[model samples]
Every structure is written in C-alpha cells, then in structure tokens.
Target chain A: MEKIISLHNQHVKDWKKLLTRKQRKKTGTYLLDGWHLINEALTANVNVKSLIITSDQLEEHDDIVTRDFPIYEVTDEIMRAITDTVTPQGIAAEVELPTDQFDIPESSRGAWLFLDQVQDPGNIGTMVRTADAAGFTGVVAGSKTADLYSPKVVRSMQGSQFHLTLRHGNLDEWIELFKKQHFPIYGTQLNPEAKNFRDVAPAGSFALVMGNEGNGLSDNILSQTTSNLYIPMNGRAESLNVAVSAGILMFQLNQNIK
Target chain B: MEKIISLHNQHVKDWKKLLTRKQRKKTGTYLLDGWHLINEALTANVNVKSLIITSDQLEEHDDIVTRDFPIYEVTDEIMRAITDTVTPQGIAAEVELPTDQFDIPESSRGAWLFLDQVQDPGNIGTMVRTADAAGFTGVVAGSKTADLYSPKVVRSMQGSQFHLTLRHGNLDEWIELFKKQHFPIYGTQLNPEAKNFRDVAPAGSFALVMGNEGNGLSDNILSQTTSNLYIPMNGRAESLNVAVSAGILMFQLNQNIK
Candidate 1:
C-alpha cells in the first residue's frame, strides 16, 4: 500500500490525465471512477493496473486491498480531482485498455452493430449496451465515433462493455469483412424509398449500420450495404435519436429472439 | 425593440429563473433556447410570450423580429447567463406552457406513453421524442418524473414537444380513463414471466407505461395494467436504458406501421 496525499503527486496528475482521449491513447490506460465499474472490470478479469481509493474507503474495500494489485490511498480532494464525476465514489481503478483485435468469424452469424461516426458519447455507450442486451456478437465503432473509453461513454455503458467484443475500426473495412462472409449488411435511411425495416426478416448473420446523430450513414457506406432500411414514422418527428434507432433495429433484426 | 444589456436587469434576473422547475411552474412559462425550438413553437402556434435575441442575431432573424411578438435584445454574455448551454444559440423564446387538460376520447384510439417516475431529464425528453415519432396521441408524465419543461428536457426534446399532447397528471386517473375506454394498458417488466412483447399484437389503441431508471414499474401500477409485458433480451446486459426500451416497445406495439 502507498499513500499519496498531495494533489500535485505524479500519480494524481497521471490519473487526471487519463480523463482525456489523447492521454488515454498515449498511455493505453483509462480510469474507472466508481466501485460498480471497478468491480465489473475485476469480475471480467480486465487488466487492472492499480486501485486508487480515498483513505476512508481503504478499509471498506478491504476485499480488494488484499488482492494482488497495487493500492494507493489519497485524500478525498485528490480523488475528486482525478475522477470526472460530480460526486466521486471515493474508489477508482486504472485499467489497461484492451488491444485485442476482435475477429469476424468465417461464417459470421448474429447481430453486429457498426457505428458510422456516431459522436455522442452517451449515444454510443447506450447503443453498445443495447447491442449487448440484444445478444449482438460485437460492436465495431468506426473512426470519428466518440472514443469508446472516454469517461462519459464508460459511465453510461454501466459495465456492459465487459460483456461483449468492442473494437474501433474503419467502417468500410468492417463492412467489407461482413460482405466477404455473405452476411446481409443493413444500413438505415429516412427515405421511404428505402426498404422498411419490418419488411426485412431477421437473419442469423447480419450487420446493422447506424450513423452520426445529425447526418446518417455516409453515402459511400449506404452505397455499399446489401440493402438500406427505414423505420416508417407515421408522426411528424423528423428522425429518431441515433441510439434509440439502433436499439429498435438491433432487437428487431436479431430474429432468433422469438 | 427593448435592448437589455445589463446582467442585473429585472427581466434578465427573472428569465434566468425559468431554468428551474419552480420558476417555470410559478410563471406557467418555460424558456426555449435556440431558433429551432422557437421556430417549432411558432409553427405549432404555441403561445410565444416573447422573443429574446442577441443584437447581432436580430438582422439575421428579421422574419421573426417583425412578427407580432415582443422582442428583447440582450448582450451575448446575458444570453449565455440566461441559457443552460455552455454556448448559447443567440436566440431563445419564452413560451406559455400548454395548460390544455387533454381529454381522452370515448374511444381512446392511439398509442399514449405514460411515464412513471422516469427521473432523467434526457431520458424523459428522448422518450417524448420517440413517442412523437411513433405517432402516439400523447405523453402523460406522472408525478415524480422529470419536469417536462425543465431546460434539460426542453433542449433534448428538440422540437417534438410541439408535435404531441404532453400532460402532467395522476397515473391512476389516466389508467382508469384508458380502462374505461377498453384500451389495453401495457406495463413493462424485465421478468420473463411477463408476456413477451413480441407475442402481443399491436393494437389500434393502447397505453404503454415505462417506469423509473433503477426500478421497473411499481407493483401498484403493474397490478393495475391489462397485462404486463417484457422485451426478451438474449444477451447478458442487465437491462436496456429506459428511453431505448420505450422506443423499442412503442414501435413494436404501434402495430399500425407495416
């Protein structure tokens, strides 16, 4: 056990830096702010680098204190300075970012959600959580999508990140991989001319592409899909929230649920 | 045109209070930040109490400036102080909150989303937007749910608030009204014992009730519904986000969308 009380301590400074995307990229590590997330990471056997806790929390988290990982005790103020949440949970963990390249099976079956520049961290996290609930095989977050390990995404994800394969890859490359496997690639559009989602029966092996919050799937991606689908909106709302749309489509297309 | 540049101006002090639920309830008016929401309110003929704008934006929005509404010009800093966003959109509106007590028809023949204590402003707003897209007749947010007119809810709702009837009423009263009309009331639960949502035929008229974030429907409400329903989840995620679940259930139960 190590005690670091100063706000300017090197460990505190490094943990604070993990809040930014650039720092996380440089160090290949991210911070989990509360017990719930840290507990999930430990359960999933994630490579947790260290446990950081306020002096008062050290005794309560004694279960983890005796574990193999290094533990650092800091003041409450230092804990608050390091975590992004308004109310710091007094316990945090630094986990190694997973670098495993998720593989698409030769005969890819089950739903896979591909985010095409979906930038909202909350939306991206919710969609991923929804994908996990829908029993999707994995989620491929395309370039320009919000960083999956960002603080906001991690908080909204609520530990579902541990349940499924998550990867950051080029949308085009992922689309091509699914095509190679002969899995139907489904892209969404607002146009009525696009095939209605209900009309497309759920399939075992398929990819459902959701686009950015404002602009939907890029024209290039749309042009590459097996078919573009639309959810018919009988009301006046211009469009559905990207995450909500993804949830609806993923559940609808995972035909094996029924 | 009234020009108000001082932060301490009486109107400025009063307008800033509209950000809170108490002030909005006291005045029966809420602030709509940005032109998109203002435009929607105008199009829907919602009683736009007044228009607040930055001096530079007045010329750009001449169409609105010349309209039959009181126009007040304020400094950029004043606009920022009066708005909740980090970056104010330079224009906003003070709208009279709709007080119409939406009467249920003898034959309540459309989807109505009843939210029970769904606390997140963003989730509440997103659900309203989804209900609007699903062509629901109205959204009745019961007690303990986030205030519909709170700045966060108003912002996340975009302009969909103008597209549907929104009410704050007693859930029991609403359920009784629907029951009187013989409309099925569908309550949601995560338990598998509940009827699978897919098996329930979409009806011409029904009430879809969504519950709080941490808890599903309260036992009292669940026991009162025509039948409780559950969305089958094949994956290991604990549960879906409240808004996403509402979107999936609303679309699946709408039945009218072919």
Candidate 2:
C-alpha cells in the first residue's frame, strides 16, 4: 500500500487546505473525518476522491482500504496535520462537493425548509437533520448561512446531509417560486400579529422559513409569507433555540400531513 | 464602592473557586456571567450574593450596582481571573443555588420532564429550555446528567433555568413515584416494540424520560416504563439529536394540553 510520512507531501498540503472555506470552494472538495462520516459517504455513494488512514487504523478499516479509490497510509503526526478536529480520528476522506443547482419543481408537493443567514454551524446542521427526519423534500441555505461542508456542521449533521437534497440559493427567489406555485410559505417570527403555529393546518406541500439566531425573519422575507406563525412560549425564555423551534415546527407540520 | 485590584484577595479567591463543581456545591453558590444572566437573576428575584464588575462596566450597569447587595469594582486582570470564558463579559455575579427538594405533587396534573444520564451540557440545557417553553411544571435531572450549573449548560439555557423548577435526583425513584400516581410515563427508545409517538394521545399530566446521547435509556429503566415511544424516522438518518427529539416530544405533548 502507498504511504505518506511527510507533512510536506503535495497530497498532505492539499488535504490540509480543506480546512478553509475558500480552499474547499476553490477545489470543489472537502474532508470528512472519523469512521462514521467516511462510512456514510461510501454507503451513500458520494464521490470520494481518496482515503487517508493512519497506519494503525488501516487493518481495522481493511474493507475501505481495499476499495478502488487511492488509499494512503500515514503516520499519526501526518494524520493530525491534515484534520481540523482537536482529536484526530486517524481516518479521513476527500469527497467531491455536490454543486448541482436544484430547480424548483413544476408542482410543489412536499415540504421544503429555507434557512436565512443562520450563522451557527451546529444550528444549521441540526436544522437540516431535523428536516430530513420530518421527510422534507430538501433544504435551501440562503447566502450568509454557515458553509454546509464545514467540519463542525458535518459532525453535528450525523450524515443526514447524504440523505436529502441540500443546495445553496437566494431564499427570496425560492420564496417567489413557491408562492407562484400556490404553496403556502410560512415564516416563523415573534411578531404580535403572528398566528400560533398550532392554528395553521398542515398541507401536503409548503415551505418553512427559519431565520438568524438573534433576529427573526428579515422584514423582506416576512412580508412575502402567506402568514407568519409563532410557537407559543408559555414560560419566561425570550425565545427558543433556532434549531429546537425548527424541529418542533417540522415534526408537528409533518404529523398532520402523514 | 470597594475596588479590588489584587487577584490574591480572599474574596476574589473564593469567587474564583465557583468555577469548579466541588466549590460551587460546598458554598451553595455559583457564578453568573455576562449582563444577560445577571439581569435574569435580578428579574427573577433570585438571591444575589454579590456582584463583580470591571471598572469600565460599572457606569453602564449602574442600576444593578446601586442595588442593596455588595458590589465590587475590579481591574480587568482581576475580572479575567474569575471568569471561565475567554472573552470575559466584564461583569459577573455570585448567586445562591436553588437547593429546594421538589416533591411529586399529590394531584399530579402538570407535565414534568426527566432526563437520564444525558451527559452533553448543551443537550441538557436545551432540553431544560424546551421544557420551559412547553410549560412543563419542572425538570428532574438524573444523577448522571451534566451539572445543572455548569457554564456551558447555563449559556445554552439562556436563563430558562430561572423560570422553572429544576432539580437533580434518581430516575428510578422518580419513575416509581410517577407510576404510583397513575401518571403515564413514556420512555423514548427505538425498540421494535416501541409505539409511534403520534399514536399516543397527549395527556394533561405525565413524565417523559429522555436518555443518554449514546446508549438511550438503560434496560432497567426501559423495563419500568408504561410504554416505550419512538419518533418515526422517514429518512435515512439513524436517530435525531437528543435535544431536537426532546423538543419535538415536549411541544407535541404540550399541544394537547392547551
């Protein structure tokens, strides 16, 4: 088997660059750390460019090592140099980014989630994971949302990204498209005029917009919604965590349709 | 106002000790950092043992400084020493811990949430926050769960802890108490025999058990549940994040009561 023992090797240098968003975007590839994520990528048939495993981990991951992809065994030090996590898992994979632009369906028939300027990587990932669990058709991350492939997001997502259609686009455009198709677009806000979420009947198709952690939906987005909804808070917490609020709405809406 | 510039002062030393769980328990006090938490403590009428603010923050927080409690002005260096965050928020307070033992009410007409061995501080805090939003009467943290007063948990809770009753106790004892009271106890697990969560009608009063992030509820605890419930997963992801799942259940059950 091929071995890479030096941090200065070209392959090592390229893999290390995956830690930055700019580098990831430029190369159209990103790193997946730990056995769970790498295994998920393989199971989902994601385009894995290569596999890098520490010499000690190769025997345990022999099945992956035997795959047709280029497998390089590296020392622990070399493995640590290329991974972003504090505790390197001794295994990593370079997978091609899914850059396809998703088109709005001619007839909207399933739930879709849109995130607007949600900055926290963990929150973004959790929202996507919940959307998938609720059987949402896809997710559209607006500009300024955390990069979908960031390591923190990948870890929190638990491989749910592989199970659903996730793409980046202008949220306003998507809202307009859904509106034109007669799909109800519900924007979550805390406005006094907003109706309680329970009051809204779940339809076979709709779009839900969740906003930034500190701010509710942007005014422009809120103005375009079929109606704004609020989760009734019966206690003193100023608001629910964005991810938790999203999960509640998704699952509750899904139950009525099912 | 007393000005403390020396980190070696006895008062500063004692306050610094609140950083550890042992010290927090011994003194029956814990640290509340940042203006938001300090404000929450005051608004909730919690016992404020003392206040510490950097020289610069004194003018902005004059209302709090003018309170009847002992307010100490400290140098930036001294303030940094007592804070656990890297970017110290320039203000903190020492507040008395709520040590009251919560008894399962005789009538048992309000909802209660129980967490078993959920170790992630963020998960614990988020669950508590969700319970508060869902109008849960109280929360009982199993002995093995994360410390309720930990800094990370406090940050994630966003002061929801102040609005509800939270106590640590044995899960087995609490389960038995609820069962005897005839309050249905639902344990979340993915076993084949587990009923879909939607199939069960929400009740006005009940105890919901959420388990550890990794192992779910222990077999012993599972055996005692009135029925094990599962969140139906329509996608490929194996399971939902503990906090997200907890939020879904809390709100769903809450909907029926309202």
Candidate 3:
C-alpha cells in the first residue's frame, strides 16, 4: 500500500485529469470512481493501474488490500480533488481507456441505435445502460456526442461499456457501410414524411437513429433514414426525453424483429 | 416590476424553503426554474404565483419581457437562495400545484401511467414527460414519491407537468378505484412470475404502474394488478431504468390500444 498525502502527487494529478476527454485521450487511460464500476472492471479482467481510496474508507475496506493492483490511500480532501462527483465517493480506480476492437458481428444483425450529437453526460450514460438492456448492438456515438471514457459516462453506463462492443463511427461512413451490407436506418421525428414506428420496421438488419436533446435527427441523418418513425401521443408533451425515446424505439424494434 | 435588494425578505426566505418537500406542500406552490419551463407554464396558462429573476438576466432580456406577470428582480445571491440546480439558469417561476381540474371526457379511454413510490425526482420528472408524449390520459404519482413540485422534478419534466394532468393519489385507494372501474393494471416488474408486456393489452382502459427506485411495487398494489408486465432484456442489466421501462411499456400499450 502506498500513502499519497500530497495533492500534487504527479500520478494523482494525472489520474484526476483523466476526468476530461482531452486528458484521457492524451494519456490513454480513464478514471473510474465508485465501487461498482471498479469491481466490474476487476471481474472482467480489465487491467487496473492502481486503486485510490480515501483514508476513512481505507480502514473499512479490508478486501482491497490483497488485490494485485497497487493501492494508494489518500485523505478525503485529496480524493475530492481527483473526483468530479459533488459528494465524492471514497473509491477510485485507473484503467486504460478502451479502444474499439470488435468487428461488427456477421451473426449480430437487428436493431442498431445511432446517436447524433447527444451531449448530456447523464443522458448518454442512461442511454448506454438502456441500450445494453434493450439488446441493441452497441450504440454508435457520432462525432458530436460526449466522450465514452469520461468519468460521468463510465458511471452512467453502470458498467455497460464493459459488456458490449463500442465503435466511434462517423454517421455518414457508418451509413454507407451498413447500406453496402444491406442494412437500413430508422429514425424518430414529427415530420409528416415519417411513418409511425409501428408501421415500418424492416426485416433482418437496421439501425435506429436518435438525435440531440433539443433537436431531433440531423437533416443529413434524417435524409439517410430509410424510414422516419413517430410514436403516437395524445398528451400535450412535445416529445419524450431523448434517451427514453431511444429506449422505447430500441426495445420496440428488438421485440418486433424476431 | 418589483425590485428587492435584501436577501432577508420574508417571501424570499419562505420561497427558499421550497427546496424541501415539506416546505413546498406547506405553501402549495413550488419553484419552476429555467426559461423553457417558465415559458411552458405561461403557455399552458398555469396559474403563476410569481416570477423570480436575477437582475442581470432581466436587464438583458428587456425585449422578450418588460411585461406579463409580477416580475420580482432579486440579486444573484438571492436567486441562488431558491434554486435546486447546480448552476442557476437565472429564471424561475412559482406555479399553482396542479390539481385534477380537467375532466377526462367519456371518450377518453386508454392506458395511463401510475408511478408508485418512485422517490427519484429526476426519474419522476422524466416519466411524467414520457407519459405525456405516450398520450396517457394522465399520470398519478402516489405516496413516498419525490414531491412533484421539487425543482429537480420540475426541470426534468421539461414543462410536461403543466401540459399534463398530474395529481397525487393514495396508492391503495387508487388501486381499489381502478379495480372498481375495471381498468386493467399493468404493473412493471422483472419477477419470473410476471407476464411479457407484449402478451397483455387491457381490453378495457389500463394503467401502467411503475414502482419505487430501490424497492419496486409493494405487495399490496401488486396484488391489485390485473396485468403484470415485464420489459424483456437480453443483457447483464436485468432491469431497465424505471422511467425508460415505463416509457417503453407506455409506447407499446399506446400502439396496441390504438
């Protein structure tokens, strides 16, 4: 066990910076805070550079000491400096930021969820969790979305990232790739040009595209959609939360595909 | 326009208490933050108790405003006193807590979303927004749920509260009432005993019941369910986020019912 008293410890400061995208990209590692996520990484055999625990919790958690990973004990204030949460949870871990390594499985073909510029960290996190649960073949975060390695996204995903393959596909390029492989795209919108989601679900392989929080699908993505879908509503809400909408659409396609 | 410089104003102090549920109910009104929600309330003609604004934003937006409602301009310090947001968006409104005033026409008969003991304010708000878009007749939040008037709920609902009919109902009493009315109760759960959501659509009007964040529906309400529904998931995430599940179920039932 290593004792880290100084807030200026180079490794500690560097790991704290991993909370930001630019830093994570530059360093190729991301910080995971909270016990659940770090535990999942260990269970999955993901490499951990070290464990950082607040001094108060260090006394309470006995199992962490025996782990092969190096352990650093720090004060609560020091932990707060490295964590982004308003109320910092006591545990943190450092791991290599995963790169896209899986091929689009030939046998895995059904509903794909494509996200366009969905920026809210919480929204993206919730969407990842929902996408995993709905059995969508890994969400495609387009150019404008939050970095998947950000601490909030890691926390929001609730370890879903460890379970599925993720790809950073430019929508245009992905659309072309899918089309060449005979997959279609479906999107949600209020345009009269759109079909009700229940009306037009294709067979075999398709991607369900979603847009930004305030804006629906980008015109470029909307234009590329083989079918634009609408979920009928009698109530006065203009739209559903984007992540919630994506969940419904993704689940609907998954249920109907078979 | 009313200009108040003192942070010690009686109304300001009372308004600040709204950050707690007890205070909100005591006053029978709560704060709605952000320009979008404030505008939604005005558009819906929700009774406005007051308009609270920071002096700076009010000064800049003279063109968009300068009229409508009693505007109270307070210092940035004072504005922070009454907000729940981490970063105050500079505008907030006090709205009459909506009651069951709109009569559901006889022609109205379909699925409704009933959240029982859902304590997360953000989930409640998002669920309300989804309920509105899914075209449910109304949403009834029951005991132990977050106060519908909390700033978190209001912001997450994205102004859906004003557009939809929301009222508190005693869970047990409402269950009995729905049973008497012969409205099918679609209770959400992952219990092996539950039926798949797609297999059951209420031939009569239905209510989609969601449970609390940690503990799902209590046994008393579960006993009243005419239809127990589960959103099927394939991944390691055994449960979908409650709001996401409700939205998916609501959309599915909306399609089946129509």
Candidate 4:
C-alpha cells in the first residue's frame, strides 16, 4: 500500500478537488465517504478509481483492499484535509461520475420524477432516494437543481443514485418528449383548481414534476402539465417539504404500476 | 428596548443556556432563531418570553417589535452567542415550551403519528412537519427520539412545531391508549408477512408508527401493532429515509380521513 503523511502531497491536492462541484465536473469523478457508500458503489459496479484510507482503517477494510485498485494509506490529519465533513470517516473512494445520457425507452411505461430547480442538497438527495424506492424509471434533474455529486447530496441519497437512472435534462424538452409518447405529466401545485392527489389513480406510465422549495412548479411548467395535483393539507402548515411531497406522490402514482 | 453589548451580561448568560437540551427542559423555554420562526410564534400566539435582535434587525422586523414583549438589542457578537447557527439570523426569541400533555379525546377520529426512537434530529423534525401537513392530530415522539427543540430539528421543522401537537411519550403507553380508543395503529416494517401499504384503506382515525433510522420498530413495539405495513421497494435501494417513509404513509393515510 502507498503511504502518505504530508498534507501538501500532490496527490492529496488533486483528491481535495473532488470536494467541489466545479472540480468534480471537470475531473468526471467525486469522492464517496464511509464504508457503506463505498460498498454500495462496488455492488452497483460503479467505476471506483482508487481507495484512500487511514492507516488504522486499512486493516478494518481489508476486503476492499483485496480489490485490484490502488490503495493509499494516509494519516488521520491528511484524511481530514481531503474530506468536507468535520470528522472524516477515515475512508473514502474516488468514483467516476455516471455519464450515460438517459433516453426514454420505446416501450417505457414506468414512472419518472422530474425535479424543477430544487436547491437544497438534502431535499434533492431525498427525492432521488425516494424515486429509487418507488421503482421509478429515472430522475430528470432540472438545470437549477442542486448538483447531484456534491458530498452533502451524495450522503443524503444514500447510494440510490447508483441503483436507478439519474441524468440532467431540460425539463421542457423532457415534458415535450413525454407528451409525444402519450405519457401523462402531473405537476404538483396547491392551486385552488388543482385536484387532490387521492383523487388520481395510478397509471402504468406517468411523469411527476416536483418544484422548488419556496415556489411550487414554475408557471411555464405548470402550463404544460396534463393535470396538477395537490396533497391536501388538513393542518396549519402552508405546505409539505418538497422532498416529502415527492415521496408521497411518487409512491402513490407508482404503486402497482408495474 | 434593553441594550446588551457585553457578552458577559447576566441575562445573556441565562439565555445561552437554552442552547442545551437540559437547560431548555429546566427553564421550560427554548431559543428560536430568525424572523420567520419568531413571527410564527407571535402569529400562533405562542408565549414569547423575550425577543433578542441586533440593532439593524429591529427595523427590518418592526411588526414583531410592535408586540408587547421585552425586546433586547444585543451586539452582533452577543447575538451569535445565543444562537446555534453560524450566521446568526440577526434575530431570535426565547419562547416558552408547550407544556400541554397530549391525550386522545374519547370521541377523537383524527389521525396521529408515533415516532419510535428516530434518532436523527432532521428526520424527527421532518416527521413532525409531515404529520402537521398531513393534518394529523398530533405527533407522539418516542423517548429515544431526537430532542424536538434541538437547533437542527427546529430548523428542519420550519415552524411546524408551533402549528401541531408535539409531545414526547412512552410508545408502550401511547400504543395502549391508541388501542383502547379503537384507533388502528399501523407499524412500518419490511416483514414478509407485512401488508403492502397500497392495499390498506384510509380510515377516519389511525395511528402510524415510524421507527429508528438503523432499526425498524423494536420487537416489543412491533408485537403490539394492529398491523404492519411495508412500502414496497421497486428498486435496489435497501430502504427509504425514515422521514420520507413517514411522509408517504402520513399523507396516504390522512387523505379522505377528514
């Protein structure tokens, strides 16, 4: 195993860049922290470029070490320098970003979730995780949505990104595509004219659009939907958290659709 | 308006204690940050013990200033000391904790949510927020759940705590109470014998139990449930985030109940 103790090591500097979205996008790779995430990445057959582990963690994660990948042993201080978290998990991996362009399959009848400018990293991650659990076909992240590879988002996603299709797309273009394919697109909003979600029945194929945290679906997006649905609020809260709303709608719409 | 520039001021020292759960429990009060939450307290008629704001924030929140309460103008440094956030929102308030014990009314038919040892403050807070949005009557937080007043939790809850019934209770006792009242208590789990959530019909009165992040409901608690329901996973993700699961269940069960 390669050993490095110096915080100023050239390799450390490059690994540190994975912490930022710009660098991650430029390098086409990002860091995954903790054993659970790394294991999930391996299970999902993601392209894991290298493993970085502290001296003590090396023995604890011998199974991962057995893999034919370059393993670097770093001091605890060096691990901290490379991680964004306060307490570094003592192990991380450089994993290549998924680059496949998501295309709607010709016979696609599965549900899909489209996020519109959802800014919060945790919210974006939870939405992706929920989409995976609901067994949706994929997620189309709007341009303004939080970066899917950011550490905070990756952590919240809990490795769901690997289990399902996640790709960036212009929501307008995708909505047009779904329309051409005869798939119903549902936009979630609280408009007075919007039908309550319970009133809608699950269809074999559908696209659900969830909006930004502060605003519901954008006006242009709302104008394009086949119908708008609202999760009727019986209590005093003005609205549900965007991710929570997505979970409810995704599961409800996807239930038995397969 | 009282001006407090010195960080060592006695009143400032006392207010700082609200940052800790033990101190909050002892004082029967907790600190609420930002203009939004303080305003929510005022609008909800929650007892505002005092208002702490920096000089610049006073005019920005003039509406809150007009309320009859002891307003303190503190230095920016002092304001930071009393707040748990890095960027002190320039304003905060000491609000009395709701002391009312939640009890199921004899004729009550409204839905309720019981959280079992949900440890993450964000998850606990999100559950409470979802329960409120779903129009559930209240939330019974299990003894091992995160402190509702913790800064992380309060932030995630987004002032929904002030809009709903939130009280910690022993799950065993509450489950008994729910049973005697004839409220169907649904425990969420992945048991093969568990019914799929889609098969369950919404009833006017029900109680949904969400469990710990790492472990589902404890064996003892699971045994007492009227029925266990699982949100079927359509993909490879092991499970949904506890908060997302709670959100899906709460909205589905609450729909048409009212």
Query: Quick one: best TM-score, which candidate?
Result: 1
User: lDDT of all the models against the reference?
Assistant: 0.87, 0.85, 0.78, 0.84
Worst 10 residues of 4 chain B by lDDT: B100-109
TM-score of chain A of each: 0.95, 0.94, 0.92, 0.94
Q: Please report the candidate that would top lDDT against the real structure.
A: 1
- Ranking by lDDT, best first? 1, 2, 4, 3
Q: Write the per-residue lDDT of candidate 3 for residues B126-234, one digit (tens) a residue.
A: 9989888877777777866667777788778888877667767676666666677777777877876788877765455778889987788888778888868887787
**Pairs clashing within candidate 4:** none
Q: Write the residue-wise lDDT of candidate 1 on B134-219 in tens digits.
A: 88888998986778888889888888889988988788888998888788899999999999988887646789999999998888
Name the DockQ score for candidate 3: 0.72
For candidate 3, lDDT tens digit of each residue in A32-129?
Answer: 88888888888888889889998888888877799888899988877888887767789998887665522344334656777898888888888888
After superposing candidate 1 on the true structure, give the runs of residues whose Cα lies further than 4 Å from its correct spot. Answer: A101-109, B101-108
Query: Model 1: how far is B26 from its true place, Å?
Result: 1.8
Q: Among all windows of ten consecutive residues in candidate 2 chain B, which has the lowest summed lDDT?
A: B100-109
List each model's interface RMSD.
0.5, 1.0, 1.2, 0.9
> What are the candidates' individual DockQ scores?
0.90, 0.76, 0.72, 0.81
Worst-scoring 10-residue span by lDDT in model 1 chain A: A100-109
Give the share of true interchain contacts found in each model: 0.92, 0.84, 0.90, 0.94
